[model samples]
Target: MRQSYQDWKGQSIEAKRSQLRGETKDLPVPVHIQKEPPFWDVFPENPEVFKLVVQARALGVLRLEENRNTEEKVIRYTRETVIGSENVEIASSWEEAVQVLEVLACRPDKEAIGRQVSAKLADADQAQDKLGLYDQFINYLKQREAELEKIGGSDSPDYKREATIIKDLITSENLQLDNKSKLSVIQLVISPEKPLVDFIEEPHISNISPVEPPFMAGANVFCTECGEQNPARSKFCYNCGTRLVKPN
Candidate 1:
């Protein structure tokens, strides 16, 4: 990935212009590093492996393998860091790692773990895809909240509130940090067929609401047609009376 970036950067302005015009071969795009289930979910079980992976990410080399013949299932990871190439083993196999990661990715506790890992990343760009993960996590919690309501029967209102709090944290912070990240999450979570500007202008359809209007600090419904911004909870635009949209 580093070599690809360097090669692309080495090209002259005329070469890039020719490539963009389809008069030359396409320029190489830098490959981004992303974990299948996100490292935060399973790595919490093996801090040592997680630390090494974090360090390795800075050097742009990371590989994972299943460790066989161990008393317990284990995962072996090889990473290239400033010191050199290093191999480390965690007490979980690839399959076991996948299972734990799947569970945590769906659980509300993932928000806490994801935040910590996102904070520790040496390259913030590596975490750009995390908004999609948080989007999926929020959706999972939303479904779970409804399931808890049905199962807990009116006896446990507070039980499902925990899900709401976590969802808010993801929506209000994690998913809102960068517009590019938000747009990426929208493309992955929302209907990709929809125009990005349509979602940006009408964030209620973006699945990450209530979105605060740019002119103000708090959530508001901005009317694209009439140019009126209403309070977050308002169902219709107070000025134009256009019905405000909300995520299903």
Candidate 2:
């Protein structure tokens, strides 16, 4: 989840210039500039998607915590903005996590965090609605693009993803899938050749169970540079304006 000092070539390290930023050179500064690790670099293939995850987690739009259920380590991203939430667990493996992060990072808006996630099997009770979530996001994407005049733009948003938000009023409980299966579904949704209708797989969302119990988890994220404790979901530390490096 973080890059080591060896991996960070440009970020700053401790210094002894005896220069204080705010106050005159009367005493040593309490904090030095320490850059946080570039976790997005960890997912070069899906940088944008991974970036969204970092941003959303920082904004408290979603919550991430250690997944103690399995022997193979995993981290869970559970929606917290809304009352009844939906969550998805992604593996710790960097490469596999990239594939899963792309799907989770497809959130269309910051509000409805995980609405479009695994739409194929998100809500079995409202299979029709679950299937329609992707379509709704597609429609919204088109409208958003038109608003931004991004029909032929380069910096346009990738609302075409299957996991962006398309807020649902009716709460859909639990939805979790193995890394392989989840990645496959995400790829299929983003595939140009696959028709939207094909995203629907009957009984896909039938396994919906109780939502994950909310945990009072935050401020656990720490900055490796200045040892600043950042908010749990923070991508960077506020004190020294550095990216958070996973502590050793």
Candidate 3:
């Protein structure tokens, strides 16, 4: 009366399908058994690693721009770190990019201070070299004493007259004696004149193009008046003016 279990299990696949069709002839198909779409088809693939690439570019200290399908975004960075500020849009040329970076790097932080200090130091050095002040002063005094002797000979009736003449000679000639000559002239005036006889060369008094006074002889000032020369620091003219011309 009842179907044998072995008979049901032994049926061929087609026989089982026929029997299942006969049993479910009046039932609708099951919803759970319906086929599902493949996993790859459901999730689309992304070709680019945009976020990771942006971070990598910043590590290299490069500013970059990414052009998406409909819009563009800029990324700015420096050698030390990425700048979080808004991205700057500029010309796309390589030369323009390089120029902008160079300008930023080369800009001085303290523009005025740096320039002012540099100019002042340059001026001071120029003044020191141009004047040769110390050397000139020593030479001037020595030449003055020699001039005093030439015109007065220590006992001339017009000592002032000789001094005045020496001063005129110094101013007009523009005599620029070296260190050695200045010392020799000083010796000639202070020591016995016989030893320095050769040093004296008839006082080469030539007319300078432009006549000037207070010609420096050696270590003294030759007076334009009275022909009497005096020490370099003399306040008054030895033979005339109570006040001497101040040495510059």
Q: Would you list the C-alpha lDDT of every candidate in the order shown?
A: 0.44, 0.41, 0.35
lDDT digits (tens) for residues 1-248 of candidate 3:
11232132223222433443455332223222334312212222221222122122222223455635325444333221165533233213322332222222222311222343234324433323222422343344344345456665445534443344434433443344444445454554543412321222334533212112354768676556565666786655545444455456
How badly does each model clash, as a count of residue pairs? 2, 8, 25
lDDT of 2 by residue, 1-248 (tens): 33342122211111211231223344333332553333534434655555444334323343445544445454445554565754554435433444444432322332244343433234443434434543444454455456556444324454323124323211233223333344455555544532221223335564322222223455376667787666666565545446666544
Off by over 4 Å in 3: 1-59, 67-75, 78-85, 89-91, 102-248
Ranking by TM-score: 1, 2, 3
Candidate 2 clashes between residue pairs 3 or more apart in a chain or in different chains? 36-242, 36-243, 36-244, 106-164, 107-164, 108-164, 108-165, 219-232
For candidate 1, lDDT tens digit of each residue in 117-236? 445332333335555445555555555456567668324654344454454545544544455456555455544333333323343354433343355556666766586776677676
Worst 10 residues of 3 by lDDT: 46-55
Error of 2 at 103 (Å): 17
Task: Give the clash total for candidate 1.
Answer: 2
Predicted structure with the largest lDDT when compared to the true one: 1
Candidate 1 structure, TM-score to reference: 0.26
The TM-score measured for candidate 3 stands at 0.14
